[model samples]
Every structure is written in structure tokens, then in C-alpha cells.
Target: MTLQEIFALSPIMLAFGVHAQLSKTTQNSTSNVKEEDVEVIRIVESRIQRLSSGATGLGLDSYETPQSVSIVEDDTIANYQLDDINSLFEHVTGINIDRTETDRTYFNSRGFDITSMHVDGSGVPFGDIFVGDMDTAIYERVEFIRGSNGLITGLGNPSGTVNYVRKRPENDFAARVDLTYGRWAKMRAVADVSTPLTESGTWAARAVVVHQDKESWLNLYGNNRNVVYGVVDGQISDTVTVTVGYSFHDNNAEGNTWGAVPQIYSDGTQADFPASTTTAMNWTYWDTLNRNAFAEVSWFINDDLNFTSKLNHINYEEQSELFYTYWNTGLDRQTGLGLLGYPGKFSAKDDTLIWDNTLQGNFNTWGREHTFIVGVSLADAQTSDLDSAAMSGFDVMPAFAGWTGNEVSRPEWAAPTEAGFADIKLNRYYTAMQLSVSDRLDLVLGGSFIDYDNEGEAWGASTSTTEDGTSPYLGFTWEAIDNVNFYASYSDIYQPQYYLNEDIEPLGSAYGRSYEAGVKSRFENNFLISLALFRTEQENLYEFLGYDDGDGVDDEDYSDDFTYALYQGITVASNGFEVEVSGPLNDEWSLIGGLTVLNMRGENGSEARTHIPRRTFKLLADYAPQWNEKLNAGVSVRWQSEVYSETTGFGRITQDSYGLVGGYASYTFNQQLSLHVNVDNILDETYLGSVRSEQTFAGSPTDYSVTLRWDF
Candidate 1:
């Protein structure tokens, strides 16, 4: 079906039971519509399991929260083979994944970059340039909140927040193993086991191990990854519990590109490169390692009160030998002689520590029962980097035409230098209350106070800053009907800037506010539907003014290193809407999908972030046949509107609208064994992987994989 038709018919089908098959699930068996039957259907409770805390830290389900939220469950992840963060987010509503290079990726939502991230309600330090490819084997599910989350995150942009929920040990004994083989000589193995460690079943432990080695469809590209995780859960008393865990991940990649292919030729014509094209040499490699340790304690003060505390520590290291190729004079269509090569060796290390504590309880107020939550969090992080450049000679490649990856000899590197260093600290105090004003109306009020400090040297300059601010949050939900709710919310955004002015002083922070309103409805059999409209306004965002001259400013003495580009603040606004639906249609079929529309403009009313698509749609559907009893199948579709980017001297480069299709199927021979198959890019659609900059990469082509599973 077309995008327009799908959007038009979704609400009608959901509200009035227009579809013949859906009617059976939406209404009772009786043909006649009675008032009592309508009321019975409206009050039907949800049977779906709920998370401890998701969008608001209130332990509320999607229909109860006053914001836009989406979830990717474990079943969906396994069926689609979403092994990595990039593949997992592609299925989320209103999320766009930009693969700028082989090993680097960026995400965008609501016309802004998504920078806020958490693991089990605790914030983590993350950036596109620093974090490596994240594996999802250790996670049970991923929760998404599609708007400003400053109330809980302390300080951040108005984009969105992502939280990953880890898999924990269960009281019962269970074990599973999987072996997979796929195209391009890919091989993978995974083992997971969980069991009760004590006779009383009050203590449990779980362990998981994974290993994968895969060759890319791109020439001269491959990688190997390994992961290990272990966790222990113990109940010290009837009202107290404790948990501890540790995880390690290592990945090594060869022939990874630093950037992507050039977009334009010397003649101002667009360049066309095959999906299998690569600009990396055989000797170049990128390797990364990560370790995490965490501990948690939960105490139930009484039936009406509870408290929880958590601590986490993380260490990360990276080493790489990379070669970057760019066209200084633009590429010539006939000769391809303008390529310039920059080879470098680099290493970096980072350490982070985080602590969070929360208290939640119920109280009787105004003849009604209300809920409140208060929390505090602390985060400390430090990082250092070393960089080495190639010798003065050997800066230009011989030719690009008919060139092989082994053509260039490894260049000699100079002495390593301290390229960057940073130390950051943050402390946050926050509280929120859910007031049960009446039987149908509920109000939520909360805010956060943050103290932040940073000291670092980067981008050939020195930096030091200290700032503090308060961000407030307000919202309300009205149960207009038994199973339907209307809600609205307001949130503040505060983000500090690291850029410096001509005077070598750090620029201040950017401030903003976000407003959102939506309607949510729950149906029988755990189906849910939501529609939201949102707007955000931000000011004091840094805007590059030009580089300063060598002369001193106002006749004052200044060093050469301080002559960097100056910047000023600017304002921008973003407005958007989203429609999402999820849950099972009946016993045989289930589906999840969404549609997003956005518009972003600068103060002058011109388009901002034009490279991001304004409209996108994603959907996934699964089916299980009753006759077969052991057969299952699924399909997925993703479509995006046209997007374009403007280069300094090359004008505009555009990527037209495109769509991709994928499918999967599985069969069980018995309770202990099963076979599964998956296919990506089923129609072999060719498109650009990323178009947010002048350098662009081609998307993946058709691929397939098969797996065998055993359960005990």
C-alpha cells in the first residue's frame, strides 16, 4: 500500500473496527452493540508486561505517560537479527541512522541530533567521534523518549533520549545456544545460561558469551568482535535485594574508511561509485575495547515506599592506523589525479564513573493517593588522546583509476603528541510528583538543578568552564475515556558549549524549551496507538563567524594559537508530529509502525538542517500460522523522503526518495531445536547511506543469513 493510504486508513481501522479481520479482535462476539458491552470493552485491562521505569521514571506504561515513547522488544530484535545499535535503531519510530563511514554513525530525531543516552536509568557519556559500534547481545530491550528529557538527564539538547535495559538473571534455570553462517564468509556463535545459585532460589547468576567474524560486501573490509557478560542477583531479606554485574567487549576492524567517497567531480558533475567501493588500504585497522562494572541495591521501606541506589564504572580504549583521502582540487572525470592522502596513527583512553539514587513513595493528599519520586546523580569522566602524523613527504596518491589497496607503502610516522585531554564533572538533584487531582485528571510537576564543570585542551586551544542551571518540567494527563488519554507537557533544555571566542574565552550555554501534546489509546489484546505534536525553540547556539587575523584584538598581546575562528549565538525552531502504533492484531498476526513529519527553520525563516529528511515511515509485521503450529514469518519496510546537502564550491547534492524491504522466516522441528533465515535489502535497492555532508557512502546491497538454535 502507498504511504498516503496507510496513514489515512490507520486511525479509522483502529477506532471503528473497519477492517473485517480486526473487528473480531476489537469488539465482542455478540453482533448487537450494547451500552454495557461498550463499557466492558473500554475498561479491558492490558495484559502486556510493564517495565520498572521507562520514559518518565514513574513506572508508568505508554498509555499512562504524558510523552511520546517507543520500545523495541527482545522478540523483535531476535527475529530481525538486530545485532548492533545501528541496525536496532533503524526500526524505531522517527529515528534516522546516518552511517558516515565504515565504523562511525550518527542518529537524528525531531530535526536535531540525539545526544542523550542511558543504561538502566543512569546517564552515560557518549559522542559520535568517541563511542564505537555497540553490540545489543547483552540488552533485553531499548526504550526511546522522543523529545527533551532535561528533567532527568540534567543538561542536554532538545532532541531525545535512549535507554538500554540489560538482561538480568532469572530465578529458574534456562540455557540457549545459537550458531549462524551468512554471506561474505560470516560466522557467529552465542551461548547464554541462567540458573539459581542457592537452594532457596533467592540467589541467581547468568552469563553470556558471543563471538563473530564477518567479511563486508565492500572490497577489502572485514571485522571480528567478542563479548562477555556476567551478572548476579541476590535477595538479602524479604524487603531488600542487591545486584552486581560486569561486561567486556572488544572489536577489531581492517580496511575501514576514515571518510566516504567524494560527491562531485572537477567538472561540477555528480560522481557515481559502486556500493562495493572502498578507499581504505589493507594495512589500516581500528581496534576498540570496553569494560563496565556496576552494582545496585533496592530496599522496600514498606508497602507504600521504596528506595534504590546504583553505581557504575566504565573504561574504554581505542587504537587506529588510518589513511584519509580527499580531493583538494576536485576529482577529474577523465584522470582522477586530484586525490590527496593523509595517514595518521592515533590512540585514546577514557574512564567514567556514575552514581544515582532514587526514592519513590505513595501518600494520601486531598483525599486521593499521589506518587512522588526524588533522585540525585553524579558523573565524572576523563579522557586523553595521542596522535602521530606521517612524514613530511608522501601526501599525494599516484592515481585513483585502476588503483589497488596495496599500491601505497606504509608511511613513516613522526613522534606522537598530546592532541586532546578533558576532565568533566556533573552533579544533579531532581524531584517529581504525580498528583491524583481527580478520578480522570492527573498532574505531574518536576525539575532538576545541575552543577557542571569542565577543563580541557582541544582543537589547538585551551578550555575551562563552570556553569549551573535549573530545568523545570510540567505535564498533565486526562483520561477522556476508559482506555484513551489526552496529555500535554512542557520541558526546559540547557546545554553548555565548549567553543571559544576570539578572546579565548568559552562561550556560554544554550537554552531552550519544548512543548508537546498527544493522545494515546489502548485496545484489547495489548494494542496501543499514539499521535503527538511537538515544538521546540532554542537560542544562543554557536554560529561560526570567520577566523581572527594574526593581529592582537584591541591592541592586546595574543598568541598564534589563539587566532581560531570566533563564534556568536543564534536562534532556531523545530516543529513536528508523529503517529505510532504497536502490539498484536490477534493470535496469528502482530505489527508495529510509525510516521513522522518535521520542519526546522532558523531565525530568518530559512530552512535549518536541510540534509535531514522531513518525512519518514517505518513498519514491521509478523505472522504465525495455526495450521503449521511451528512456522513463523515476518517482513519489514522503511521509506524516507528526499534530502540534499550543499557543498562550498560544488552546489547541491541530492538523494531522491527510496524504500527498502526485508524478510525473515523460521521453522521448529521440536521444542529443543529450530532453524531461521533472514534476508536484507530483498529487492536490492541502491541508495546513499548518508547525505548530511559532502562525503557520502553507498548503502548495503542484498544479503542473507541462516541460523540454528538449541534450547535446554
Candidate 2:
């Protein structure tokens, strides 16, 4: 379908009540509802489950929460065949992924980078530098909050926050197995089992194992991955519960590239390369391993009060031997003779520990019910890196006319040396209170106090710093009618910088503030629609002026050997609006759609981060016809506006507007067996996956997958 048709379908579907077979399923009493209709509704509701207390600590639903929230459940993951975090983020609203390299990816939202991520409401470290691709088999659902979350995370950026909820052991005994095969010589298998350990069903254990091997569209690239996860839940007494879990993930990839393909040639003209072109050699590789352990305890004091404690630990390691190609003298259009290669070997290790405690309760005051929450958290992390390089000559590459990946041979490496080291500690105390001022209005107040410290060295430079600060949050919600709510919120956060100034000193810290207002409505048949407007301001951001040559003067001759960077602080602001609609259109159709528009500028009235798209739209829908109870089908569409990046010699690198189409179908043979088929890029559209002044990468072509599942 075309973009115009997709945009117009939203209102038409809601107004006309298309496919009116399941309209009576929403009634409080199922007296007139059919047995099959009731079952369909139940399954739909479970697939699109809602979260309680995802934005604030007062346990408010999406309609009552003052911030915008979105969730992706297990059913959606399986239907789309999303195996890693990179693929999952593509379906989330207002999110963009930057595929800078084959093995590393960066995420951004609202014209800023996302720096905060949590598991079960507890903060953890996240970034391309800390870990590689994360597997999604251990998570039941992922929640997103589209604004500054100061009350939950003490120090962070204003882009957004992500929370991953884990899958737990069930009270019953069940098992499932799946085998999948896809294009590009890809194969996968998964096994999951859950059972009760006692006759009383008070204790339970669950385990999951996964293995996958796949080849990429790029030349000479492939990967092998494995995952193992296990969890146990026990009831110590009628009022107490305990849970523990562990997970391990390993990924090994060959022929990994360090950067993207060059975008410009020597004559300041654009260069065109095939989608299958790559700069990696046959001997290059990147491997990573991640391990996580967590434990939790809960106590139910009464119906209105409760307490919980959690502990989490993580260990991550990575090793890579790669080659980076650069065009210092620019590539010749006829011969491609100016390319040079730099080979390096590197390893990294990261360790983290976190502890959190929370207490919450409700009370009666002034003829109204009020709720309060208090929590404390402590986190410590350490990271170290080692590096090595070839001692002899391995700098020139053969001509690109008839070049193959096997042309270059492995180089001799030198002794490894310490590249960087860091130790970070954070302690935070937070509190929140929700007051029901009247039958039509509510108020929320919260804040966090944080103490942060870091000590380490990076590339022969000291990175030690210390800071302490407080972040504040406030919000209000008013019920305008029977099923409508109007809300507004304000919050702020702080982040310490690692960049150095001309005098060789740290740049202190940066601060950010967010303001938002929105309206939400719940229509008949459980349909939800929301419209939101937001503004964010960030100050003290570092900007580069020039490279210093130790003589207090800017010089191009020492560009490769500069001692320090001349930096200054600047302020930036971003304004945006979003509209989202999700729910079942009728008994047979379910839909999720969103549109986002953004504009960002610096203090000088110039556009900032021009490489990010200014507008994006996403739509997904599923159909389960009553005529065929055992068959289902779905479709997905995504579109984005133009983006451009500027460079000194290449003028501008631009990527025009583009759209993608995908679809899936499934058939159930019996109660214990099923088959599914998925097709991606059905339209066979060609586009750039990433566009930057330095380099660019091509997106994937049409692909297909088939899966067989069994349940017992």
C-alpha cells in the first residue's frame, strides 16, 4: 500500500468499525459474546499486555502516567523473528539505529544519544563500548519511556530510557521447541522448558537454550552465536518470595569490517559501490562473551504496603583483530589506488555490580488516598583495555578494480600494552509521592540525590573526576471526561563529561531539562490513542574548535600529532511532537501506528545533528479471520524523511526519503504444532542503512524465513 493510503486508514478503521464480528467482546458481561470470540480477545490482550508503574513509582497505567510509554511483547518478537536488540529497536517508535560498523551499533532518539538502560527497574551500564549485540531470548517484554527519567535514573541523558523485563518460571509444567531456516544459509534452534519442583507447586524452575549461524549480505562475513539461560522461583512463606537467574551469551564473527564504505572520490564526487562490497580480509574476526547473574527478594507486609530488594552482577569480555581502510590522499576515480590500511589487535574487559532496595505503601489523608515510594541504589563498575599493532609495513592495498577479500595476508603483531582503564562508583537515593487532590485531579512529586566518582587513565591522559547533584521531577494529571486524561510533566538530569579543554582539564558536567504535555483517550473496545508535545534543553555540551600543536596556535601540519583539543561549551534545544494509536480495530484486526516530527537547533540558530531524520512513521497490523480460525497474517511498514551530513572536501552526503515493507503468515495444524513464514523487504527497495560524512553502508535486500514450532 502507499503512504497516503496507510495514513488515511487509521481514521476510517476507527469510524466505521470494520469487521464487526467481535464488537460485543468488550462488554462487562459475556452473555452475548461467542466462546471463540472470548478466546480470541484473551489471546490478543495477552500479546499486547500493559505495564504498571513503568514511568513513575505510583503504579499508574499508561492513561494515568504523565509520560509517554511504549512496549514490545514476546508475541511481536517471535512474529517478526527479532533475535537481537538491534533488530528489536527498529520497530520501536521514535528510535533510530546507526550501523557504524559491522559489530557495533549506536541508538538515538529525540536528536540525542540514549545512555540509560535498566533491567527490572534497576539501572545498568549500556553503550557500544561496554558490550556487543545483546540476545533477546531472556526477556519477556521491553518498555520505553520517551523523556527524561530523573526519578529513576540519577544521572543520564534526555533522549529516553529502556527497561527489559525478564521471563520467569511458571506454576505449571510446559515445554516448547523451534527450528528455523532462512535465506543466506542461516539456521537456528531454540528449546525452552518450565516445571514445578514440588508437589504443592510452590517452587519452580525454567531454562532456555538457543543456537544460530548466519551469513550476511556483505562479502566474506558470517556469525555463530549461542545463549543459555536458567531461572528459579521459590515461595519461602505465605508472605515472602525469592527468585534467582543466570544467563550467558557468546558471539563469534569472521570477516568483520571496522568502518563503512567510502562515499567520496578524489575529484570531490560521489562514489558508487555495489551492496556486496567489503573492506575486510579473510583473517579478520571479532568475538565477545557476556555473563549475567541476578537475585531478588520480596516481602508483602499487607495489602497496601510492600518491600523489595535486588542484586545484579555482570561480566563482559571481547577480542578483535581487524583492519581499517582510510583515504588520506583521496581515492582516484579510475584506479582506486590511494587507499591505505591500518591493522590493530585489541581486547576489553568490564565488570559491574549493583544493589537496590525499595519500600512503598499507601495511606489515607485529607479524605483522599495517597501513595509514596522510597528507594536506594549503589553501583560499581571497572573497565580495562589492551591494544597491539604490527611492527612492520602493512599499509598499502591492491587496486579495487579486481580486488578480492583474500588479497591481503595477516600481519605480525607487537607486544600488547595497556590502552585504557576506568573505575566508576555511584550512590543514589530517590523518593516519590502521589496525591489524589480530588475525584478529577492528581499530583506527583519526586527527586533523586546522587554521588558520582570516576578515576582512571585513557590513552596517556588522566580521566579522574568527581561530582554530586540532585535531579527533580514533577507532574500532574486531570480527568477531562469519562475516558480522557490530560497530563503535563517536568524533569531534569546531569551527566559528567570526559573531554579535555585547551588547558588539559576536564569539562565538568552537562545538564538537561525536559518539558512535556499530552492528552490520552480510551475508546470503546479497548482502543487507545495519545498525542504529545515535548521540548528539551541541554547546556554545557563540548564543541571542538581546532587542534592545538603545543604552541598555542592552530596548524594543519600537526593534524596527526596534536597534543590537545581546543574545546568550548555550547547549548542546544530540540522540539518535537508525536501521535500514537494502538489496539484491536475489531474481532479480527489489531493495529499499532505512530508518527513523529522533530526540529533541533543550537544557540546560534543553526540546525544540529543534520544526519538524523526529521520525520518518521511506522505502522503494523495483524488479521485473524473467523472463517479460518487456524490461520493468521500480518504486515509492517516504515518510512523516514531525507537526511544529510557535511564534510570539508565532499560538500554534503545525502540520503533521500525511503520506505520498507514486510509481511508474515502462520498456520496451526494442531494443539501442539505450528508453522510460520516471514518475508522482509518485500518491495525489494534499495537504500542506505547508514549515511555519514566519513562513510556509508548499504541496507539489506529481500529475505525470507520459515519456522516449525512444537509444544508439549
What TM-score should be assigned to candidate 2? 0.89
lDDT of each: 0.77, 0.75
Regions of model 1 farther than 4 Å from truth: 1-50, 125-130, 392-394, 499-507, 542-570
For model 2, what is the C-alpha lDDT against the true structure?
Answer: 0.75
The TM-score values for the models, in the order shown, are 0.89, 0.89
- Put down candidate 2 lDDT per residue, 1-712, tens digits, no spaces: 4222432453321111000111112223333556645433322222233233477755566788888887777778888887788878877778877776788776778877777788777765334222456778778878888887787777646778888877776657888898999998989998889897876565778899999999988888888899999987655554456677888999998888887677777777766778777888888899999888777766645546667777677788999988777655677888888777767789999888777777877789999878888988888778998988656325677776345777667888899899778888878899989889999799988988888888877666677888898889999999889789899999885876666666666677779888889998988886788898999999986665554544655343333333455567779899899898777888998877688899999989999877788998877788999999899899988888998877667567777899989978999999999999999889888777676446756778898999999989
Give the TM-score comparing model 1 with the true structure, all chains together: 0.89
Clash list (residue pairs), candidate 1: none
User: How many pairs of residues in model 1 come into backbone collision?
Assistant: 0
Worst lDDT 10-window in candidate 2: 14-23
Instruction: Give lDDT: candidate 1, residue 163.
Output: 87
